[model samples]
Target: MKKMLVLMLTLTMVLAISACGGKAKESTTESTQQPTTKTEEAAATEEEFLPEPGAKLVVWSSGTEKVLVDEAAKAFKEKYGIDVEFQEVGPDKSIERMTTDGPAGVGADVFLAVHDRIGSAVQSGIILPNDYHEEETKANNSDKAIEALTIDNILYGYPNSVETTAVFYNKDLVPEAPKTWDDVIKFAKTFNDPKKQKYAYMWENGNGYWNFGFLGGYGAYVFGKDGSDPSDIGLNNEGGVEAMKFYQSLKNTVLPLKTADITSDIKKSLFTEGKLAMNVSGPWDTISLKEAVKNLGVMEYPTLPNGQPMKPFSGVKAFLVNANTKYPNAAKLFANLITSEEFQIKDFELLGNLPSNKKAAENDKIKNDPFASVFLKQFENSVPMPKIQQMNAFWSVHEATFTSIWNDGVDPKVALDDMVKKMQDSIASSK
Candidate 1:
């Protein structure tokens, strides 16, 4: 009976040991398998957001921009192991090409545009609003540059360069930059001799783009304050008529040169030859002015007689992404890369472009450039060009008003009132 009891106890102990071994093996297997599942999930989440490794991106560029764009493309491809192809298209012609190609899915993934064309592009639905790096881009770029590119309070593109007209003077001719319109008039009385083709200042005064500063300085505008409303035109307001009268007085009293006689080429030649003391021009004239004149200097537009600064129309150059791009994420990444601080600085170095990136504009090279620095100062008081579609009609009306006042010697108020009526009719017809 004792042997039977002892054998029963040993069998029970062996069964308990077997159960303990099975539990240990199960725990070991679960611990090993759990981490593998979690690791796979983490990797997949990372891969989901990353751009495809071998995607190809197409870019549209102008011949003048080829060098900078090519360098940027090579750098982008090296970083992402993607391929980039560039098509040489002029900046002015890009909008038309995109309009035809975007809907067909044959347009470039990215292209450059002027800010004034944003309204038209948005209306046409060719360009897409930037969705990536919004905060980073706004924080790094100039406020005005960003504001110029925004339509209906939404940013449309990445601003790369900023340009506006400033007063370029000959240091030897003027001795000092004029501080006010009155000073310019005072000097012009003695300096200007139309018979000799010598003048204190010369500009395309009949063109709306160049003459907008005069009207705008007196509170005239093509559209409403935000530039989004087309019905509210301010170009023929009380201040506008008064501003026109002032402009006519200058042409009649101080400057005898007519708009037809003083073309852009003539103005450039006069300034380069030291026949003109001061001229209103933008950064595009920098290279030629530097080579042609020995004592070239730049200053902000002279203040008007009514204690207002001459607020020239400003334009920003930006890159827009095509709405029909197959690789939206990759296209956005490339846009950000091209507008980066490094690339902006390189563009300034190579092309003499005024960078819209605040950090890039602050570089020692830009800071030391006399011409560039004056433009930066003038930008403070400059107004952005209207982005409304009605601006197309406003140009012709503006030229007529200027011609009637400056060329035909018509009364300023009468001409402005007629211009307003014609402009309203044009706008109504377009709609």
Candidate 2:
């Protein structure tokens, strides 16, 4: 009986050992297989994930257009989860700040200002090219703006607002609008009461801005037909001289105003009081004139004395992204949204400025607006202001040179010769 009990015990011990072995093997297998499943899950998670939120962007805008810029930025933040820190700086300070602070990472991630500053901004190596504007987006953009931003086929910014010249007249003084420049001249002559008040037409006699539209209408241009080529300055050309002569003819017919003499306040005071028949100014002048005069009328620039339509130099205001921005994608997203139609029209309504987006201009809200449509149509006949750095130097000297010629009896040819020489010299010196 003792031997039989011993054999049963041995068999039970062996079965227990086998069961323990099988359980150990299963434990080992699970440890190895669990990690594989986790690895697959981690890869899938990465693939399915969306970009992280809570990105922030810093921006700066030229002052006084705050109403327009602010609303647009607000819309951008709402559409995309972003925080925009915006500052309003003077128009002249925008480039200075960017050039000094952008590369250091202390400046704006995006900059909203004029396109004329692009040449200097690009050369500074801080403002980046917007190489990805979709074909549809390009289709609706201002061609002049596109040209301004494009440097050797690379575009630097998308245009938002276009500043162009239009005729603003006192409805009380000129019951009928003039259709041609000759009519305007005739009208000015008839209305000449300079002894009592300033005569008919007035514009800042400083920058070539006052000349661009008139000269353009007469088949003359600052830089010939191809605007980018500076070598073909039409200053001495026959068409150009004729345009200058026409301007000179107006010398005795109207009250002369220099850039320094005619401040914004002074211009508005004269025009609103029905002291002047017509004046050339930009969209920025609209609000003040509307406030100053109860009845203000705006129209396309009248035809040139040569009977050609007046084509003004279009000025585009755009936002440029900082190449050094840590959040480039976010900055680009904000830029794209601001230029979108929905946001643009809202900007127009709230700010009383024209929108560059074609679809936005066509919206019922914008199309039906009597004031908006009138200025918007002027885009059809505008060209972008020069994007060269020399343009700044040119603007600085313009008032002195033009005033001397227009009012002080300085020879127009001599003034133009000196002007062209200085402009070319300025461009060379900048390089």
> Which residue pairs in model 1 clash with each other?
none
lDDT of each: 0.84, 0.72
How much does candidate 2 score in TM-score? Answer: 0.80
lDDT of 2: 0.72
User: What is the C-alpha lDDT profile of model 1 across 78-104, one tens digit per residue?
Assistant: 878878888998666787799989999
lDDT of 1: 0.84
**Model 1 per-residue lDDT at 409:** 92
Top candidate on lDDT is: 1
Any residue pairs clashing in model 2, and if so which?
A: 314-383
- Which window of 10 residues has the lowest lDDT sum in candidate 2? 43-52
